[model samples]
Target: MSRSDEEDDDEDFQAESNAEEVSAAYKLFTHGAAGPITLGHLRRVAKELREDVPDEVLKDMIIEANGGVKGQEKDVGGVSLEDFESVMKRAGLSFG
Candidate 1:
């Protein structure tokens, strides 16, 4: 196969792997729920895991996960799966 074809195959594999990672992380945060993950949900999960993460830090995470857009930090309602995936990618974080 050509170099370009190999590159495409690699990209496809990477995409599938990323999707799986995001799905797992999202499920962990949402407890298998079918809605966007909220700050409360994150806090509860952290507490359950005994992570001791501060609320401020969690808020910042929510904002960042929401793309850190201008004028939206204060109104971040929740973190959708897509937003979570984007933030995880941007931060180089993985569930693996």
Candidate 2:
């Protein structure tokens, strides 16, 4: 039994969508982690995204996500889950 081309295309699209979701989660976590996530987590995710995003872009994202203050440190900086949701809504992203 073999699958059809349409099946393969559907599978590929689904896989790509899943990958995008993973990437989005990493981006969101890197930007909005309150405490459960750590520096190591951000470093790993940033390393993964390096192949796709430029270093300067990531720096800018970090700065923007951190409320315009650069390198405030996580202990003193973070977006609450409620606030994260609000920001996401403002940015046209939605959460279930």
Candidate 3:
């Protein structure tokens, strides 16, 4: 079935938001010596974001964006640059 114009607009907005989030993620990584970002970093970035996204939501977004993993909490194995980018692209955020 074809999508309505409003649906299409929403999709476009989502895409834009994702890009902004990705940019923010990258900036965080760079700020931290251009290294991979840890879950801690993600939390900090999320909190720094313009929108006040809850910790639970951020955690869920991280898991979902990176694909489910076992024992991810306290893993401390920072996400690779590529993975970080991918997660931001898949999350609900905006750079503006």
Candidate 4:
């Protein structure tokens, strides 16, 4: 059994497609001019993309693309101690 000429073309096409995927992801994920910088930007992108995705899913994707933390990934039941400390510090109520 051997490969056909068309298989080689398909591989080349796939490689080009993969490169495009990376380019687009990098542009969007790195907060380029078109990325979400403020709540308004997020709202605008959400409005534009809502038809292709559910609200919750789109929100999560936007967060991930903006390099958001994955603090909620570990457990959905309760917050971690470190998370609580970070939140408190941000709120200017940290004990230490």
Candidate 5:
């Protein structure tokens, strides 16, 4: 309950919060987004988010996937939340 102890706890909390914020910043988009996410689909994605997606991050994932901004293409590996349930069913990751 000392002042130094409180200060240390505050520092730890701040560090954790900052780390979470930084991680969130790098997350360009999330799953269950209502449509496909390919390079060709960036415009739709922006619309779904109701804001402009980060140019750098969106461009990078699309380029990494070799997508051409098309709106209908989904990740074949089914890594997105939209397909995650099915994938978990196949992989048996589901607890239920």
Candidate 6:
């Protein structure tokens, strides 16, 4: 195959892998919930993982994921799967 074809194949593979990873992360964090993930969900997941992250830190995470807009942190509802994926990408975080 040509070099261009190889690059396309690699890109396709990476996309698929990223999708799978996002799905897995969503399930794990949301605990199979159908709705968006909230602060409660994150706290439960962190507790289950034996992590001792503080509530303020968790809130900060949500705020940061929601574009870090000043004075709007208190209005955050929850994070959808798409937003979660975007935040993870922007933060350079991955399930792998």
Best by TM-score: 6
Which scores better on lDDT, 1 or 3?
1
Displacement of the residue 75 alpha carbon in candidate 1, Å = 7.0
Per-residue alpha-carbon lDDT of candidate 4 for residues 1-96, written as tens digits (9 for 90 to 100): 347778877777876765555445434533455422333444455566765445456456444433454434431122223433344345554232
TM-score, every prediction: 0.72, 0.37, 0.43, 0.31, 0.32, 0.77
Off by over 4 Å in 3: 1-30, 70-78, 87-96
* Predicted candidate 3 versus true structure: per-residue lDDT over 47-69, tens digit per residue: 66766777666667556645655
**Model 3: pairs clashing at backbone N, Cα or C within 3 Å:** none
State the C-alpha lDDT per candidate. 0.79, 0.52, 0.61, 0.46, 0.47, 0.76
**Model 4 regions more than 4 Å off:** 1-5, 25-41, 49-59, 62-96
Per-residue lDDT of 62-95 in model 2, one digit per residue for the tens?
A: 4455565433453423333444444555676533
Q: What 10-residue stretch in candidate 4 is worst by lDDT?
A: 75-84
For residues 8-42, could you state the per-residue lDDT of candidate 6 as single tens digits? Answer: 88888887788788888888878887647778988
Report the Cα lDDT for candidate 4.
Answer: 0.46
lDDT of 1 by residue, 1-96 (tens): 999999888888887887897898798888899647888898998999889999889878877777663244565577888888777777875433
Error of 6 at 95 (Å): 13
lDDT of 6 at 75: 55
Report the lDDT of model 5 for residue 3.
100
Residue 88, model 4: Cα distance from true site in angstroms: 36
Superposition error at 11 for model 1 (Å): 2.1
TM-score of 6: 0.77
Q: How do all the candidates rank in terms of lDDT, highest first?
A: 1, 6, 3, 2, 5, 4
Query: In model 1, what is the error at residue 70, expressed in angstroms?
Result: 12
Whole-model alpha-carbon lDDT for candidate 2? 0.52
Task: Return whichever of 2 and 3 wins on TM-score.
Answer: 3
Quote the positional error of residue 79 for candidate 2 in Å: 5.5
lDDT of 5 at 57: 64
